[model samples]
Target: MSIAICIAAACLGAVLLLPACALARSATAAPASGIPATGVIGIEEGQLNADYWIRQQSKPDATILDPRAIAAQNKRLHELDASVHDIEHLPARLTRAQVREWIEAMSQPREETLYDERGEEIPAATLAALGDNLALDTIPAEQATRYGMVVRRADLRTFPTRLRVFNAKGDSDIDRFQESALFPGTPVAIVHASKDGKYWFVVSPLYAAWVEKDRIAEGAKAAIFDYTRKTPYLVVTGASARTVHTPEQPGVSDVQLEMGVRVPLLADWPSDKPVNGQHHYASHVIELPYRDDQGRLQFSPALLPRAADTSADYLPLTQANLVRQGFKFFGERYGWGHSYNTRDCSGFVSEIYRSFGVQLPRNTRDQAVSPAYNRIDLAEGLSHEERLKIVKTLEVGDLIYIPGHVMMVVGHEDGWPYVIHDTTGITFRDRTGELARVHLNGVSVTPLVPLLFNREQPTVDRITSIQRIRP
Candidate 1:
């Protein structure tokens, strides 16, 4: 007879850490259903499916200017935590939470705040507040003022309209500007926006004022805001060209450029943007955008051709067994062109459906607009009843999308809807358990939302529409 194998490390460790004979009690604890012993966790395993499990070995501490360094620090913390957990099993009588506390204390390092341009660290209070699950959109006004990062040119997208630039860094005050007056695709910075949907910006140093809600993309990722703290005054010359350069050094005074395109600084240059002619000068200028080892302007394949799956069966109802098969390929680091290392959005969808013998389109937009086996035209819009009818008509394994994206609604896990899609990797987002957007580099699966599904210019926002396809 075959044995249903179970790994005892997670349970045994938990039991031994409790106390004498406490092992017996902990040993009797069966993990919640559907949760397999992943060696790191013993609880119902379904909870472990969240796209990156960040174990808080240390107590939440300060805000970091460069959060990138945390990964290196976390490695040491994990090692120390293992040692702490090793001793807790001595029958010393501790609650489970207590055991976890001690383990965390040993594993995590004390939080440290990173300093700003002035060489002073942000306040501990500010760091602690940042630790809270604060939505990017609901930032408190006081904190916004205190931590306000000033950037020159930021890209903003108005819902259902073309993306435009707003001059958030006004040459003067911002009380005199008008939203309607702001030019499309013009760069702007965030001075202030209220939860009530009212806000103000500086179109130029001389112009500033309130803009309507429809004028700004709510909670959009502010690229310029991120750069201002590090590299200030990065100017670009070619207004119509795709490639631009960055200043070599920080705090360099602006150089005279051209018009129809302000030589003004641009922020959040794409990973693939050209760097030639971009120079940085703290006091003196230095050329950059160096050639690669092969003597070519550095280039990497950011997007691949979209392919469609051509498998035979694609219905979840006909393939119910996949519900229990979690894409357990977690803890993998991200890599470009290497889907095996980290899953991209289209890569995840294509591979998963392939496993089930269902062919799917390889790119988000293509998959979203593929010859549907149903179509939901958002242009005409639909009532709740109509929407439900359309949704109800969907078969298991049928894909749902916004404009140029796709998501697979799987069987419920622990009373919540589980969706499988490609994020930076194959990650899961748990909203109401049922509805979640595929968030990768700030893009998701919600319809009517603007997405960077296609990298080509001019035709970028053209989603066309959404489609539902199944075999």
Candidate 2:
């Protein structure tokens, strides 16, 4: 027998038992014997467990020849089941009385419908689009329905509960650590979830440590508008040279730029720079000047002002790409008299910056000493909170300095630091050489430094304080 027929028979039986009672109130505000009327009642059956049911009757059918009518009905039933599963999972400590009380406090279920393979008898909103076409041709539109299904599937995934790291060597368990040990900006991947309802993540290549899911967003696929996983860019002539839309590829091509590159930094551009200067072009390198709101390029572009708590325009600098390129340019000979024998520290900084439309001074001390840069002054010691607040405000291409040297922190991987700098006579000799003239030039940090000054690290006073001049 159909559900409607069974319900009708039961109602008739009840009415026969007490005609006066039926006349008094047909719609009761309490749970009727063997039937629930108040609050959301869950229907459990065949893979359909603990589904919430709203007080909605099925809408009248539209099309006659539609084939998916049964499928549509089944889909609606499924949705109802999903909604109640989690609600029932609430602590068992609550008694039936408390459950009743909690149910009373809940909101009513909003009515909805479901869809099937054929567009007919299906909810209109569930229709899928193929390319520019709505695919209405596949499913007859004549069968569309007004009512939609309200199923409780899953909500957005929450922060991962657990995190750990392992060595990149053979993807084994040689050197593993907890997520907390990772430095800011260090790259890591979310591993499996924990039994205690937590998430786990780790740095890749190195397989470093697992961290909370809150620290890492699921890569590219999870991104909404700009679904780019990894964006590669070059720091040419102290400005951002070219941004490749794709992730982590070596050797940036000019041909790609001619085709029109996506401006990932559009949200953070000159605003991140300290000073605002007119864009200029000289030689092969372009001297793109950072501009502030006042039309000057004298402040650090890293400190670009932004509205508090807005997610839009939260573009990121590609760290994996920088690491790959930084290593690629590793063994090239260092250039002194020549403009491009190899990259010096300042030359490297200049090249990377020029590529992005920002210009920096030629030397570290000059770049460090420039008054045009944004000033984030700190003495010797401060708490991590105080230091991080200032660092969080920094953007790409920002300068980080220690006693006598400087480096750029691009971004973070597993919350660890990555830096790029050129040291004297430490140019790339060649690829895969035991020992060439090439020695240890400093490494470039992504999203750069997390702390410039702190109360614990008094050594910071000895080093030239970092100035953010890019706008």
Query: What is the per-residue lDDT of model 1 for residues 1-471, given as tens digits with 9 covering 90 to 100?
Result: 011111111111111222222222122212332212432212245434432111211211222212233333333333432321122112323343443332233223215434433444446664444323112244332322111112122212111112121222221111111111332223333334433333332222112333443333222223323322233222221111122223442212122211122112333444444333333121122122222333222111111001211112221322232222223323333222221223344444444443433334434544554442245554434443444344444333445554323555443322222344333311111111111111123112211111122121111122234444322
Q: State residue 16's C-alpha deviation in candidate 2, in Å.
A: 99
Q: Taking the tens digit of each residue's C-alpha lDDT, what string does model 2 give over 258-285? A: 1011222233244233222322121121
**Which sections of candidate 1 miss by over 4 Å?**
1-318, 324-326, 330-340, 372-380, 392-395, 413-417, 424-471
Q: What's the residue-level lDDT of 99 in candidate 2?
A: 29
Residue 224's lDDT within candidate 1 is: 29
Question: Candidate 2: where is the Cα deviation over 4 Å?
Answer: 1-340, 380-389, 424-439, 442-463, 469-471
TM-score of each: 0.26, 0.26
Scored against the true structure, residue 419 in model 1 reaches a CA lDDT of 42
